[model samples]
Target: MSAEQAESEPQADLPGPPPGPAPPSSAPPSSAPPSPMQRAVQNYLRHVTVERGLSTNTVAAYRRDLALYTLWLAGEGIDDPSGVTGNHVGAFVQHLGTREVEPLKASSIARVLSSVRGWHRFLLEEGQTETDVAHETKPPKLGSRLPKAISIEQVEALLDATRGDEVQQLRDCALLELLYATGARVSEAVNLNVDDVIDQEVVRLLGKGGKQRIVPVGSFARAALDAYLVRARPQLSLRGTATPALFLGLRGQRVSRQNAWLIIRAAAARAGLDIEVSPHTLRHSFATHLLAGGADVRVVQELLGHSSVATTQIYTLVTADTLRDMYTSAHPRAR
Candidate 1:
């Protein structure tokens, strides 16, 4: 029976789970052109998009990972889904995790292997294949890494470095201040529209998975934004056709992601700070400072638009390590 037909069978009428993994098949690679792997992958992607209702970013990640896996399979002279074996899956895992070609961090490799496992599980559930070739494949364990943050002094220095009467300089200072104040992702910050800031006190942010949250704007950020909108934004807006984006390029277009990165990096350089800085540095500082000041994890999770409180809990570790370092430096006890 076809995989779709097997799926249509009633629960009680279907045969029990196979006693063991499907026996290895010796069928030679078909002489004809291979097509099943690509077809099956497309079908599985559609299933995830329509039935599972995943976000676009997630679906895109899945597509990218599966594309890499398909390339590896083609390289191994296996193109059909049914021809995939446990050994093939194992080798692919090794290929992703090792430095034989381009080395990837453990988290990146883990995500790729996870995508592979999900694809195989979908195939098995759909009855596209009898064996779950990737069921036992394991990704490398990820190490615990603390979020990187700059001190308040550094952030102040960075923002102060951008002072000028020029429209672009005003906008850059406002952007830096808003990022630190709101703890917004770079994407979220760049995506903001004029209406997202309400009453000069709070701003609305759209986050991943299409989630939206409101974060308060501190007095410093509010003042900076006021200056930009009044003194800088109108001049910038005149450069191009009008747009609703809160942050605009010199041409009045919505600020692109790369443009935002350059703004942050330039400001950091002018601040005379030697540390590596990215847009996320401000976000990390926001979260760490909040937690260090006793903000609840759940509150920070909501403000940051994280789907789970567990993701926000990582900042607590940053705070604890800071305390440990302080104790090591200040305590009177002999080493």
Candidate 2:
């Protein structure tokens, strides 16, 4: 697929299934030991999970991508790491692109190739392979796409949609408020504990790679949170076992990421928003609105917990576009 096609395609919540037929079923019982290639993949996964401190979702994506790579290797009658060559690696890339059924987009293919490259590098370092054949291989270059963000008015409408006196309503309001206030990923927001926010001006968030960062809470969000904690949470907590989680489900257990998504969707629908609004939309709006208000890009980077300022710079593009639009409409000499 072309880079433009990759940019246009909507990615799944998790990486999609690998190209070609499904990998060998682990369902059937097998007494035989795993192949050398299989063992190498497992070791690499363990390294990433434990040593690298990758998130569970990230490790799962790596597992899916490598499963396809190993299956393709077996199809070519090569089961050992040392037996694979650069030519084989190149051919596998072709295989991913040429598959007729559910062909992967260029971006998806690129992500899978990244998984393959990481595994090969691991093998070379551990002396399981004589050379890193996949080293020279490269993924397709992806086209840059701007993130979508709603206006401040739209965000207010969405937040207002959740306002009510009921326990669920108060909880939903606080959840949405916290998301916008902190620019947190849904996973990070749902993983928060009561102690992370209680009696504090700032909230603590655990981000990718187990990195922690502190972000200040806006008064609007703080008020909503206070209402939930004071009135709603106590009632909800009575339903189930004690836990440190700040957000609770109907059963009083910690809310899940999926549940958080549903809350955002329902609120968006109630607010009559025409555009799609995921948790990431709030994050995008948070960053974009901050930039538009003259906040330093570096400060926004820190607030969002982005390791690289370059990633945070993308929101500036959105603000730039908005500026161009305003200039064209307002300036009489501008054409």
**Over 4 Å off, model 2:** 1-29
Please provide TM-scores, in order, for all candidate models, with all chains considered together.
0.84, 0.89
lDDT of 2 by residue, 1-335 (tens): 42123323455798889899988987987789998988999999999999999999899999999999999999999998889999999999989989988888899999999999999999999988889999999887788889999999999999999999999899999999999999999999999999998475799999999999999999999999999999999998998899999999877778888778888888898899988899999999999999999999999999999999999999999999999999999999989
TM-score of 1: 0.84
Q: How many angstroms is residue 119 displaced in model 1 relative to the true structure, after the best TM-score fit?
A: 2.3
Show the colliding residue pairs in model 1. Answer: none
**Candidate 1 lDDT tens digits, 23-68:** 7769965787438998988998898888887767789999999999
Instruction: State the lDDT at 149 in candidate 2.
Output: 97
**How many steric clashes does model 1 contain?**
0
The whole-model lDDT of each prediction reads 0.88, 0.92
